[model samples]
Target chain A: MGRWKNGILITYLVAIVFPFIFLFLLSMSSGWRFPDLLPEYFGFKNWGKVAGTESGIAQSFLISLVISLSVAVSSTLCGFVISRYVSYHPKKRLLTLLTYFPYILAPVVFGACLSYYFLKMGIFGTTFGVVLAQFIIAFPYALIFFSSFWNEKIKSYEDLVATLGGGSLTTFRKVLLPMARGLLMVCFFQTFLISWFEYGLTSIIGVGKVQTLTIKVFLFIKESNFYYGAMSCCMLIIPPVVMIYINKKYVFNKLI
Target chain B: MFLEVHDIEKSYNKEAIVSELNINLEKHKTLSILGRSGCGKTTMLKMIAGLTPIDQGVIKLDGVRVDEIEASKRNIVYLYQEDLLFPHLSVFENIAFGLRIKKIKDHIVDDRVIEMIENLELQGHGSKMPHQISGGQRQRVAFGRAIITNPALLLLDEPFGSLDAGTRKNMQTLFLRLAKTFNITSLFVTHDLKEAILMGDEIAYMDKGKLKIYKDRSSFINDPETGVLAETEFWKQLKTEQF
Candidate 1:
């Protein structure tokens, strides 16, 4: 049994980590060529080019950060309210189903639909439009995570708070908010990651002007700047790593 | 009349659950609802607490119609079987939840929670999380959570059902003593006839969604029509460890 478990663990490790190892090697390589077991030479040259030069990658990084943070906050807050309301009203399942329609659509197809609407509204290439698109795409994830958590804890606590003469706002602030803190944190991180790494919607809606790290990475790949693209990919991995570390250190232990 | 539940009815899936239920509760009294599972006892309690909606009829508190009032504004605290103490909060913080909801001053919240901790003999346990405490301690914390804000009505749904027999008896005693001490009106729901007789000032027998009130404990125990005698016989047989 132990050996079987170790075998399963190794399979998961290979499945998840092998791509990163290949990408790291590719990023460090001096040249892109086939028929070589390894790159002839490796250096910090790619990292230097991306970080030192006036590459738009840095700006893209910052833009992605802002957009992701905004999307995470707005989606989580709105989704929290919608999910809680649905939980209170058993008859609102149809409304909940309607809210999830965007999430069920193909990302590219949904992006096309949203781009059409944004174009008609004259905000197609704006940062606000991009943020709005990301928010809609990520809202269902937040709703699902928070709704499950709310279904477990909020109903009983709401009853308890109500019995104590707390109004709606008071119940939300005092009971629901505190009880939901952990799940909210989870939703925040999840939504932020989703928005940060989103490529298809951002590319389509932002129309190349409202660039993000993902857009920069894809652009570098298109330009055949393999080293710079790999470096951008590496940079793209940092925020999620930092987020997971912080979550493990601060949020995980207190969540229960 | 501190609470008047008038003609309250609820149904699920087009089937009647509670039909035109009416009851009057005064201050500092114990009303125990004895019923089988799925008999709408819990539904009635939730309706009174405004946690569940009434399909028809009205609930009034102090002669003020409260049917449309939100559950939070009803001032009806409910204790569940699972204790439902906030796992993330310490015993003191768990008890302070109701007071905090009422936006009581921080220092007073501290004082009252501490007072409850002492009164309930939960002194050293105040700093511990819900999971760190015993079942009895958790139940006491739940009771403290409900009573801290001095709610106009307290609803208990088999609050001691999860405890061991010894702990259940101790909790019953503690509950009665605390209820009397605070002069708080309470409605308790239990399947155990012995529990009803021990804790209830007035016993309500409910079966098949209909409620019949008995005069008092002895009358309830002796009356064959109320099914109390049969239930008591079952309890006695179970206590004697006879099949």
Candidate 2:
């Protein structure tokens, strides 16, 4: 049983890690021939080039970072508020159905449908437009995550706070927010990742103007610069890996 | 009467949970409500605290009708079964939450909280988080939190229900001691027949949305409808190892 369990775990680890090994090697490979299992040479030149301040890769990354963080904060807060209401509302089923709609619908299809409104609103091709577009998907995800979080226990806690002479604002700041600290951090990172790797919505709503890192990866691949594409993939992979590690080591440890 | 719950009615899905429920409790007196689960005892407690809306009734605290008052301004604390101590808060901080909410002076809050800790016999555990404490200790912290606010009426809903027998006994002793010390006016609801007798100055039994209140412990014990006399005899037998 122990051997079987270890075998299953090892196989699962390998399945997850196999892609990253290929991505890392591909990103560092400088001279590789077709039909060859290994690259002729491996070097840090691609990483060095991308790390430069002047590189478009770096610029696109900064843009992705800003957009992701903004979307994460806005979506989490808005979703949390919406979820709180939905959890207690008489029409909770209706609210929950609405919240899940965007997540169920394809992003590309949704973006296409919303593009006309974006143009009329004069937000298309701007930072606001991209962030707003990404939030459409990110917000619903957060709403669902949070809707399940406010259970009967939390309701009781809220009542306790109110009974203890805590007003709405005081209950939020002193009780709800502190209690939700770990989950909030997790939601933030999850939403950030959603926005970070989003390609379709950014492509259409951004009108090819708001170039995020995922867009950079696409551009690198289009130009047949597979190494640079792999480098972008590596850059993209690093943050999530670090975030998952942090979630495991720090944030989730605090959650019940 | 310091607290009067008059003709309170509550219903869910057109089924009455509590109908025309009336009880008047003196200042600093503990009213133990005995009922089975789903007997509307908890609903009565919630209605009094303004946590649940009363379909029709008046809840008067100090002769002031407070049913219309916002829950925050009601000054009625409800202690739940699980302790529900804020996991993020240290025991000291949890006890001081109400004072902090009232914006009491920092030094005063500290002094009162420390005194509460000593009373709870949790002096060494004050800095620890809720999960770090034992079930009994958590209840003490929760109890301390409720009374530290000097609430007008405290509603305790099976506060010691989840504890082990030994811990439950200790918590019951602690509760009696603290109730005496603080002179707290409380409505304690429990399904446990023995616990009802143990906790209340006066006991009320609920069945099918109606209340049958006993004016004194002797009356409660002797009431044929309550079956308390038989239960008492059984307890006596168990104590004498007659079972």
Error of 2 at A215 (Å): 1.0
Tens-digit per-residue lDDT, A189-256, candidate 2: 99999998999999999887998999989988998888888988988887788899999889877663
How accurate locally, in lDDT, is each candidate? 0.84, 0.89
- The DockQ scores of all candidates, in the order shown, are 0.58, 0.77
Which candidate has the highest TM-score of all? Answer: 2
Off by over 4 Å in 1: A1-53, A91-100, A103-105, A251-256, B55-58, B231-243
What digit string (tens of lDDT, one per residue) describes model 2 on residues B1-243? 999888889999999999979899999999998888988988888888888899998999999999999899988898899888888889999999999999999999999999999999997998898879887888899999999999888999998889999999998899899999999999989888889999999999899889988877888778876778888788899989964
Looking at model 1, give its docking quality level.
medium
Backbone clash total for model 2 is 0
lDDT for B15 (candidate 2): 99
Pairs in clash, predicted candidate 1: A162-B72, A163-B76
Off by over 4 Å in 2: A1-55, A253-256, B232-243
